[model samples]
Target: MNDTSTTPEAGAAGSVRPTLAAVARLAGVSNSTASLAFSGTGPVSDATRERVLSAAKELNYAGPDPRARSLRRGRSGIVGVVMEERVGDAFRDPIKIALLDGISDEIAVIDAGLLILTDAGEAAQRIEDAPMDAVVLIGCSPRLDESVAMLRQRGIPLVAIEGDPADDVLTIAQDNREATRVAAQHLADLGHTDVSVVTLSLTRDRARGPLTDERLAAGSSNTTLERLSGVRDVFPDAGGYVTRGSFVEEGRIAGHALLDDPDDRPTAIIAQSDLLAAGVIRAAEEVGLAVPADLSVVGFDGVRVDGLWPYDLTTLVQPAIDKGRAAGVAIVEMLEGGVAHPATFTSVFHLGNTTAAPRAH
Candidate 1:
């Protein structure tokens, strides 16, 4: 048998990959001219471009190396999207999908790619070492302040979507407190005093149980704390269940725990997310309780839930996509040596059939 893979001039790979310099030499042009021909960023004659392309094809060269171009530009052409949860968990929410769509739309203008990083799980290492020109923190928690500090020290432009306000970070904030307050007040006006809440994970531990004073104090998520505060503002001492994530299953568990109590049951339940509200409605049905009549359910984030029809969930319609766009624009401005002012957006109240006055007992 004859072993055939090695060449005298080539390393173990059989044939050394051609470089731009080799292509330039073969094309009889300067390295810079060859680069400009391929990049189209500078003035290059049609004849020069053709020569470079021919040379590249002959040597099986794939134009300029992205690593070298990134080195020359001193940028990775990557924008990091930092999430507090796993990427899979984030993608499960419709609101997050819309937000990502908006972010992608704006970043495409600059020919930048997104790098999704999570503070938890295996993706956590990337949060500290990834080469990103800028980073957008979505639903950041206080525990990640160290990560933010490190990113700031590295001079990476930072933007936050509903994150805790920092000194230099540009934030795209939402009216979580005000929106929930309005939703709660709507329930208040419906002649229902016994109202409960199904909250998003208050802390990173994600302990699923009733909300206690210690748990409330230990809550790290800014959005959850703000929304919970809003609910308390209306129904002081109104207790509720804390969920593990923003999933419908968590909502169903909470709904069962809250509604199954024979001694005391809330006439209305305020879910932190629309999906949670839908789950709460499902749980209501499982217990033979009709929505709006036996129980009124209200949700935040105007997301369309499948199988949630005929119950146009009463919710605070938030501009999730606009918020993402604002964050992307802020990132671009910061990268270009411009200041991006912190922006706060309000949610509109959408009256839906999911909520109604509690039935007379």
Candidate 2:
């Protein structure tokens, strides 16, 4: 008995994956007919489909390649979402989740899926080579110039969520400075003269520590810088810790560092994110300091924080999901040969139970 298997023979150059055209040729059918039979989208006869399947089995053909199909259609049906943080970190943050949901909501109209990519480490390669119809940047990354340049070189449509990217990229702007200013003014009106700020990442490194002069000068994160400027407008001497990311744990760390010292601690702390603010509140509790009584804490990004039952956090409620949807809509419009203008969103200040007048020492 002789073996008739189609395995690659020894001494042969690299084995080529069998193509659908070869299957069609063996089945005695045209390429289009073979494709229709595999996809089950056209009017191919059962007999013809059976023949095509049999030929495919014999040739070890797995069906039409998605890459080839995309090439033929001149569209990948993929929307790439690029962020500066790890994929896990991005999901951990609720604001990030909201933005993603918004983008998904709008892109669903075109039957497209999302491919999340990061600017650091291994995922950087995908940012340059992924087959994306368009891209949405999550925030102002320190490596924005490099990522934008590479994507633009590939001629992919670009949309930024809050980054100050190049002029060509359509930015979905948020009023970070104005909103933070409102929160700061609220603290000021309440007579919070000794105020401090807990900021987000100041650079792509996402380093955690006190905000030194050098760090402030080298800051590249647009959201952090903008919010910092807003707070400074009211409290010129405001200074606080720089967190690694928008996690409650990071905020707690900043909170401990600030609240540990009673003599030098500020009366109020303005956190860049709600999660951070929650952490600050926790730290205040740890040190026997009650929020709005001993320490006034203000947070941004009016997201619902779990386990925050007792305190209503005063914050700036920005339209996170709406911002994401706008970006997705812009990407779809650009892909369909329509113009997509840049969009700006405002944040409304919510008076919660977290902030109050300082008590005399």
Candidate 3:
């Protein structure tokens, strides 16, 4: 049962010998038998294994050491994921969850593990020392540079998902700008010149409210700026409200502000993400406005939101899961000493019920 009565020996100066050896000694078996008793790697008689385990509990041994195993393999078996936002915040979004699920699916086939590293204070420091064979940057944000530099210095293989096409690192890209352009052109074709835009956060601060012109112009995130440019391609004069996070609440806030004043309200609205489009939809509904009837809205990212309100959201669906899987595959390839070409993907336009011809005032 419990080996609380066993005494531990001084292993090597500061370190103490674990209870494994003691368990073997007490059980009157060889040290290798004791190891097998704990590791379950080899056959051990029922009576012999039970005694070894009993001695372990008395000695307070937590079990086989992870550090020792990692050192032996020269690998941590952990894939570091560097995200632009806080770790908790990143996981909170369904988009991030789905992408991570895809990554997990791939890594599971290889028996690897995922480790999340946020671009925060001490956690940033850990990036340099943490044992990881490879790393994947979730998005291209200015905040990622320092971490990327650390990973590179360690000679770690790096893969960036939905990030810039950098020289040293492998990239998995989406047609963010081009896809947005396609979305914008759809509205333009519908004769909606009075179109306005609701955009995602341009910086890590991600202030959860309306975005000012200065912030929009100064955004450090590549995707935000690129998507905004896509909108401008069709409506050069169309102005917009920037949102801090891509959450539905942020979209709702932006939508309310853009649609509040009838005199200034645009005939159409373009949201950078599907969640934002849904928020714009909610805002319109709150004001007793009709979709495509009173106000038209179009969104990007064709991610199927379960139980959508009405007309399917007119948006561009990018392969977010594929983007993640590509990054994981590239990291594994690089770690295995193989060269992998960067992956670039384009988005497809889905004309849903949320967008249509602008209503005559």
Candidate 4:
């Protein structure tokens, strides 16, 4: 049975889609010849190639089946990028966007595609069963151990960006602790002892509120903990609010909480990110306080903040794109059976007009 049965819907609705073997049979060629003709990878005569293509056109065949091709190759050609945040929320941050771009640029060499995945909600199921040749974990997700256990069971290559290092996993790290230490030290040198910090989410649930001792103890966000350690290195007793996410609005909320009381306001604020620093600036304006004049603010990540005019932020500028590219390259190398080493990046301090000596109260 050649499956040549035809129905009334064959003309407009497209016949049950002709297979490559069917095209080969109609072209009077072998199955391998038909494949070679389509792929142009074998030494098929031009006339024979033309005939095979003509038969394919007559039968309305698009090409060889991709699923079949992957089956033969034993690779799904998909690289999973696992993030802890929602896809929509992840793209809102320019840092995430830049990191993704870098990963895409390197993975193109293998002709592989990216499958954006998360470790929460409905997408969690995909983390366990989705077909992936390799995975790149982004940020420090509290569920990292569980994700690693499943992916390791599948024997997929793993590369983590800014994640806590584990056995057989490569981590692309940045100088969060050291960079923030330098930034905080700058404030300390300027005699700004009365300082507070605005930190990123420190728990899996991203609980928002004052950063209490209990919350600090239960924190698992590696990046947040590292940056906080850096701040503590300078101002050991510094305290402030913790945000649910890395957004300007969250920073505004934290800023208000820390700056509302004029009598007990700190002379300086160290925000975990530039966006948060921008929001803190807005909060200061709302409270009729001047930056560097009334309070000095420092930020991390050297990203461009929109509408932050007349004030160059005194912050740590990290190589976000480079970090991403390194992770991508490592993933590519590992997939090719080569050893990939862990990488650490440093952040440079940019002296901007945002920080100055505090005024006498």
lDDT of 2 by residue, 299-329 (tens): 9999999988799999999999999889988
Give residue 361's lDDT in candidate 2 (0 to 100): 70
* Per-residue alpha-carbon lDDT of candidate 4 for residues 1-361, written as tens digits (9 for 90 to 100): 5555322212346745556555666788754456557655345689999998998787786664446647877777667788887776776777877786677667655545567787788788888888788889898555678878888999998889996746668889998999999999999899888999999888878888888899999988889999999999998998989998779998999999999998989999999999999999999999999987998999988899998988899999988888878988998898888889888999999999989988975
Cα RMSD, model 3: 12.0
Who wins the lDDT comparison? Answer: 2
Candidate 1 lDDT, 1-361, residue by residue in tens: 7433222212334367555555566788754456556755334689999998998777676653447648877777677888877666886888876776567556644545567787887677778888888899998887788888888899898899996747667889999999999999999998889999999998877788998898988889899989988999999988999999889989999999999876789999999999899899999999989988999999999887889978889999999999988988888888777778778999999999988888887
Q: Candidate 2: lDDT of 214? A: 94
What are the runs in model 2 whose C-alpha is more than 4 Å off? 1-72
> Which residue pairs come into collision in candidate 1?
none
RMSD of 4: 13.0
Off by over 4 Å in 4: 1-69
C-alpha positional error of residue 212 in candidate 2 after TM-score superposition, expressed in Å: 1.2
TM-score of each: 0.81, 0.81, 0.79, 0.81
Question: Mind sharing the TM-score for model 2?
Answer: 0.81
> Candidate 1: worst 10 consecutive residues by lDDT?
3-12
Model 3 spans > 4 angstroms off? 1-69, 208-211
lDDT of 3 by residue, 114-195 (tens): 6677667887787788777788788767556766787788888888887553567777877888898898898888888888
